[model samples]
Target: MFDIDRWREIFQSINKNRLRSILSGFTVAFAILLFTLLFGIVSGLSNSFKSAFADDAQNAMFVRVWQTSKPYKGLQTGRTIQLKNDDFNYVKDEYESKIQYQSARIYKNFTLKYKNEANSYSVRAVHPDHQFLEKTMIDEGRYLNEKDLQEKSKVIVIGRLIKADLFGEKPALGKRINVNGSSYLVIGIFSDEGGDNEERLAYIPVTTAQMIYGNNDYISQINLGYNPDLNLDEAISFGKQLERDLRFKLNIHPDDQSALSVRNMAEANKNVGSFMAILYAIVILVGSGTLIAGIIGISNIMIFVIKERTKEFGIRKALGAQPLSIVWMVVQESVFITTIAGYLGLSLGTYLLSLIGDSLEEDYFIKDPSVSTGIVVGATVVLILSGLIAGYIPAKRAANIKPIEALRAD
Candidate 1:
């Protein structure tokens, strides 16, 4: 219901105590602003950390050769631990049936030349099965196949960044690019969520890399992923077993510091989850503390407002105004102030978040930083609730004033 007279009364009250009302409103606005910014930063960092695992297979782990750090039986310290084709075959023969994807890469520094332009890139020789393991997405053309590996084809797949740098806007597929003066047909252009470094590397058949770069069955690293159908517990168990199996097969010590390095993404995610949980708790605690201070500020101001309006409330009561109406008036004014201030804070916070989100480059640690709609809505509800609760006691005090006591006031 539109109550012009009631609105006029509320405006009169605000106008009379302008400085006090402004201070109260500013407190609420500043509190919400602080809370929202802190939360958005935390949320952005969380998203950035999660982005690292994007498009990657579940329970995937990578293994690389590591030199011995401690001396053991018949092995001296500082000896380089080499992983070759036989070691790879041994692991595959034992675990191939249970493995979802397994691959090894032969990496070398190679210069790629096209049309008189030369650039150095990480030219890696990879198996046909390595595509799925790396979560490689072919934007155009095709990735290396089994046939390419068998025939040791001189074909290379470049990243989008490489394509932009090397080929410009022209089509690159089927074009022969020189790798150290050897021609390799551009068979594919691929993209990955693993960021620009992963994208910038050029890929060729693993066998070709071994023939050209490696004298024997030398491999740089081995990668594996669990079957998709496996449950989380099953996947974790198999990953552990595979780690042990590989170490045992390689004759590496159980406590060897550098015999091998296995990066278990599933375990990393679990640790990240724990860290994020702590972060969430910290955000909530800090936000709640600021919110409480704002609520207290509002309640203090409302108490003063009620005291100032004591005579007015009494006169209204004597004039047959309902006690409930007086309470509603007080509560409504408090709600209006807090709601307006909170909305301003929320708008400014979200605007800042949008700006930061657009400008920030996504990395392994932090991505787009912003609060969800639910958090905004929740904050709004808190604002309204804080107003009502802050006003309730003072409203009751105002309503309890007898007309006789009010009339006696000078």
Candidate 2:
């Protein structure tokens, strides 16, 4: 029902106690503001982590060799562990169905040049499968294929940043670039969202890299993507099994922790995921706590308002006003204050978060930070519920006031 009389009374009450009403409203607004900022901060942290490790797939795993720390099977403690191309072949042969993609890399730091322009970038020799594992996008031409690997072709794919720097307005396709004095034909251009670092790299056939770098059968790193059916923790266990297998076949000591290391992207993702969950919980608890404090303040003020209006409420009763009317008046006013004040805070908070979110550079841990519509709607609903509770008891007291007793008081 539209209650003009009740609304007029609410406005008159606010007009009379403007300072106190504003102060009460400020409490609710501040609580909402604080909560909004906390939510955005947590979102930023999550985005940062995802960007930081976006270079690899969540199910990806990598293995690198190091010097053995302990002697085993009559081998010297100081013996260096070296993996061969045979290791990659073994996995592809045995676990072909279980794996999604795999690649072996041998990298060399090269001062690459096209005519007079030059840039120092890391050049990696990789399998065609490496393209999918790195999640790289092709801007032009084609990536390294099996033919390039088998024939050991002197063809290279440059990153987008490299193409822009070296080729400028000219097309990079079919052009020849020099890497440490050796000329290689540019076959493709690639790009990544992971920032300029990934853009500064170049990819070539792994066979050619191994041959040219004088590292026959010696890969610097082995990276692979396994079944997506496995979750973060399950994928970690999957990677551990491969690590153990490689150690056994390569004559590396089982206990030689330093001799071999397999880094599981799934494990990294799980830890970050757990931390993000914790942060989300903390944001909810803290936001709820702050809002609750403001509700308490409103409840306290309503109690005081009821006390001061006791005589007025009694007079209304004497004049034949219904108890429900008195209760409703109080409740309506509380709801209005809560809704309006909380909304102002919500708007301010959202604006600030949007500004911050836009300015936040996409990094490893943080990405775009915007509040969902559900959160905004939910917060408003919470405010309205809190208002109803804050006003109920005080309104009930006002409704119950006796006319004779109220009149008898000073």
Candidate 3:
């Protein structure tokens, strides 16, 4: 019920032993603070890992060629390996069912001129599906279509930063820009989550680059996204199979990674997912240990406090106080201390995480450290329950003591 007198007694008792109460409360607070910080930092690490792959489609794979590092079939080391339109056609024909989206890329650097404004930017000649593989978002107009690739159209799509630099408040769409002296129409402007370097690029049709740059059918790399219906293991197996087949077709040694390599997003994603799961499990174990230690510390303090007040409890019993009243008072005090202290710890930890923000992203790969609302609520419940248990045990034992024996306690 509404027992103001009981509350007054509890408050008076707490005031009488301020040092003991502070010490108990501090133990709980520090444990909760440590728990919060640990979880928040791990969550930040998870965020960093996710953002690292945000630039590309989860199922994307890349096939790259470079100079041979090992001799194979009488061919000497250091021979430059090259990918061509025929190789791209071979992949498309061989894995038509397994492929979702495919693109051939040819890298170039061109000085783009829009009237007086001019700057050098990285250019990629690619197929239409390159947009999805790169996760490029078109802000205006449209990306390259099959018609552009077939017609070898002199149409280009520029990045958001490129548009801003060359156009500067002017509409870049439908405007003609000179690229290495040749005029090309800007069909679209796009942005990428891959950061500034990605946003400063321009893309044209791969066929156009092949026709104009070298008058030959040469490509720098091939990118493809596996069918989303395939599971991770299946996707990985597909990538390996494709890689081995490509090595055989290109006359490169099976172990010669420098000659030809396939980079599979599926393998990277699986490894990262496993790593994060293990990390979270470890953090949860450590956090639970901290909470248990806090509970034990408070329990010990309560036992000591009850022992010290045994004589007082005996006097109250001699004066006709109920055992229930004694237990209730002690439990109330414990709960009060734990609740307030836990709240303070939670608040302080969250504030510290907010202050951390993205400051650790560059060096530690920790981004936007934080704990979830459900976790906070769960922690609060645990603290309250622990307080109740801590108080109940010692209070029960003290209440049961005979008045004479309790009175004799020193």
Best by lDDT: 3
Question: What tens-digit string does per-residue lDDT give for candidate 3 at 86-186?
Answer: 99999999999999999999999999999899999999999999999999999999999999988999999999999999989989999999999999999
lDDT of all predictions, in order shown? 0.83, 0.86, 0.90
lDDT by residue (327-410, candidate 2, tens digit) is 989988888988898998888988887877756654423467767788888987999998898788889988988999877656
Which ranges in model 2 have alpha carbons more than 4 Å from their true place? 1-4, 180-182, 310-328, 348-374, 396-410
Against the true structure, what is each candidate's TM-score? 0.83, 0.86, 0.87
Candidate 1 clashing pairs, residues 3+ apart or interchain: 48-367
lDDT of 1 by residue, 316-406 (tens): 9999999999999999888888998888888898888887775664432447788898998998899999899878888988899999898
In terms of lDDT, which candidate is stronger, 2 or 3? 3
Per-residue error for 69 in candidate 2, Å, reads 1.8
Question: Which RMSD values do the candidates have, in order?
Answer: 3.7, 3.3, 3.1
Poorest stretch of ten by lDDT in candidate 1: 358-367
